[model samples]
Target chain A: MKDFPGTPGTLTGLMLRVGQFTFAAASIAFVATGVRFQEFTAFCYLIASMGLQVLWSLWLACLDAYAMLAPRDLRNPRLVSLFVVGDWVTATLSLAAACSSAGILVLYDRDLGNCKESVCQRYQFAIAMAFMSWVLIDISSLIMFWLLAAG
Target chain B: MKDFPGTPGTLTGLMLRVGQFTFAAASIAFVATGVRFQEFTAFCYLIASMGLQVLWSLWLACLDAYAMLAPRDLRNPRLVSLFVVGDWVTATLSLAAACSSAGILVLYDRDLGNCKESVCQRYQFAIAMAFMSWVLIDISSLIMFWLLAAG
Candidate 1:
């Protein structure tokens, strides 16, 4: 086995840090700029999801360390493939959420519930799914990792 | 170094097949038996998510080939780790969603919109998130995988 100059562990650590930083910056920006009760509330939820997701990403980064340093001897190859694929899913989901959070801020600017087919309203389903799904998947994935680790 | 007995070339293919199967089965079950208009609608949504999720799982399964067949020098550790960790996240999310989906189906039976308890309401939010989320993540992950492969 080989190790990167910074160690494979640090590479993931960097990603987690950047993800957290983006989420934090977004939250601050949203609160400072967004208006309306629902928009504000959704912004808060978005922040909450981002916060949780960063932690989730970090946790998986650590697991990557484990998989490299100490993958189970009798691991299922199919499961390993599944694990990698799911990581992409979560990261893309996170990115979707980041874009949606921006969209949410836009919706707040326009107050789209009072309007229709506005950019925010048009993709609100995707935007809303972005944040809400992040939370749901984050919590669920955390549980799954714990189980896999324990098992 | 080692390959699984049967590795699917594209999780994309599997996801499509699973989506189709889930839709057909869920739809047939609903139509052949009986369901309220609202249940039918929710079922429709569930079927969409469920089918997509099947593809997501297959995608992860397919990634195993990269892990097994790629030349050692050409393999990128960071990229490989990303693939494996993603598989873990998606699988976990699927398991969590399977649990949540079952719960939501029950709530759907009881009428989710009318619920008043804060916890129940939260679960409603959580389940709705689960349904849309797994599917969204599935599609987004595939796109990202393609972009990375293309880039």
Candidate 2:
């Protein structure tokens, strides 16, 4: 496919693909675990992740659509705005998922009974670090996109 | 002080610092449990993780030093070569550390002579996730850098 939002599209695609695989893996785990413990909470988080990813993906697709459709000489700010929307929403979800995962861990430790794993503790740690990683990427991406837009 | 390779440097710093803390935490268990048990292998992996992290932290520092003192604009392809070197080395070490952590987990499970809570497993899983996250970031960053450069 032709490039859309220039460099920002690459970042978006990378993030979305990562989200896709992560959610898919989590779903597989949910299926394999037998009982539906951790399902509601994890599913909520997974859907959020995938929802943001799909929106971002569609935005890119539309950006592509616009790029292909816009007149060759046109220089519109709307395209850039489309990307920024994706950037911030992804950032918000990235932050939310991380925070909620931590909160869920605390609840689990208190024996809320939504999850059962001999290693449930590890999920909290895993999600927290994953959140940090995503935030780093999201923020840097926002900066880079804004700079490219503004510069 | 400026953000040269911002994502790479920041994530590396976070991983190295956290990984070291994990190493120390695991070390206490590994040592307290004595050297013969396979959690000692976990200890060994911790040390290995620490050693590799130290190298990464140094390399990132060196890149900063080189950028600041080498009298070169970072836009120069030659100057940007640092990212490639750092990315490859980081990818290799990260994968190795991840694999070693997995091995340690198996060994720890098999040799119950060690392991207090599942806490150490959290350390193992978190650091492994950290390393893997950075590797994904590294690969994507290079691809983004290349595409941006190419365009």
Candidate 3:
């Protein structure tokens, strides 16, 4: 299989993982700082999901950094398979969390006319960060999938 | 790769597709019959997502049936790639839709204490069906991904 920019062990891959970690962390930060985010199940779920993403991405980023420093191959079939599964699972959870949080925010802001509250903007920022995290993970998953397929 | 039960061109694959279609259709039916699902953007998003799932699954089901009747091969690499992409896209959308709808339902029923309304029950049923549909599609997508990797 032809090597791609974001293939495992590459600098691009490390950057992708860092990006995912940053966004997920930001998501959790926003939600945690917001008032009464725990009151809504969706926000809580978002926090949990983003927390997982942060951990997963941080772990992978470390691996990627080590691979870059060691200049070792990271395309072993089993390793790639593991990456694919992990990426897909995290991607799904992140997307679901973001969507659910966004749904609740929209319901409150538009339907119930509650956007005037400062917390709504915080929720929106958190959800947007979650979404950005999801997008990065989705890309990573797709690339891992393609790599596995080509292998 | 060893052949699996739910591999494309197999009876299990057909059954999975049919299951997805049935659940998605039922979700839409429940939501459509309920009062003012359009009032909330989340419910409308659920309807739209499930409607897409219904069409996608129905079309795939028909193809599966035809393959079974003809005993035709359905494991072409390109075709499997297409299936992987389609299944992944639909699965993500279905899950997001289900989660978002469920979030709204939870907010209204538990947090807001609105479960006494009959419409709440209908929405719950619809969200349940959506979740069921997502489960089937998730299975299908995973299988497709495995098949693509093995191809």
**Highest-scoring model, DockQ:** 3
For each candidate, give its TM-score against the true structure. Answer: 0.34, 0.38, 0.90
Top candidate, metric lDDT: 3
Candidate 2 residue B51 Cα shift, in angstroms, is 5.2
DockQ score of the complex predicted as candidate 3: 0.61
Supply the global lDDT for candidate 3. 0.89
Docking category of candidate 2:
incorrect
RMSD of each: 12.1, 10.9, 2.3
True contacts kept of each: 0.00, 0.00, 0.77
Residue A11 in model 1: lDDT? 45
Order of the predicted models by TM-score, top scorer first? 3, 2, 1
lDDT of 2 by residue, B1-151 (tens): 1333342334443344344334434433443444343323433544555456556555555554555565433444454455545554554444444433443443334333365556555545545554444445344344334433433
Give the per-residue lDDT of model 1 (tens digit) for B109-147.
343344446534444443444434445444434443333
Error of 1 at B103 (Å): 16
lDDT of 1 at A138: 44
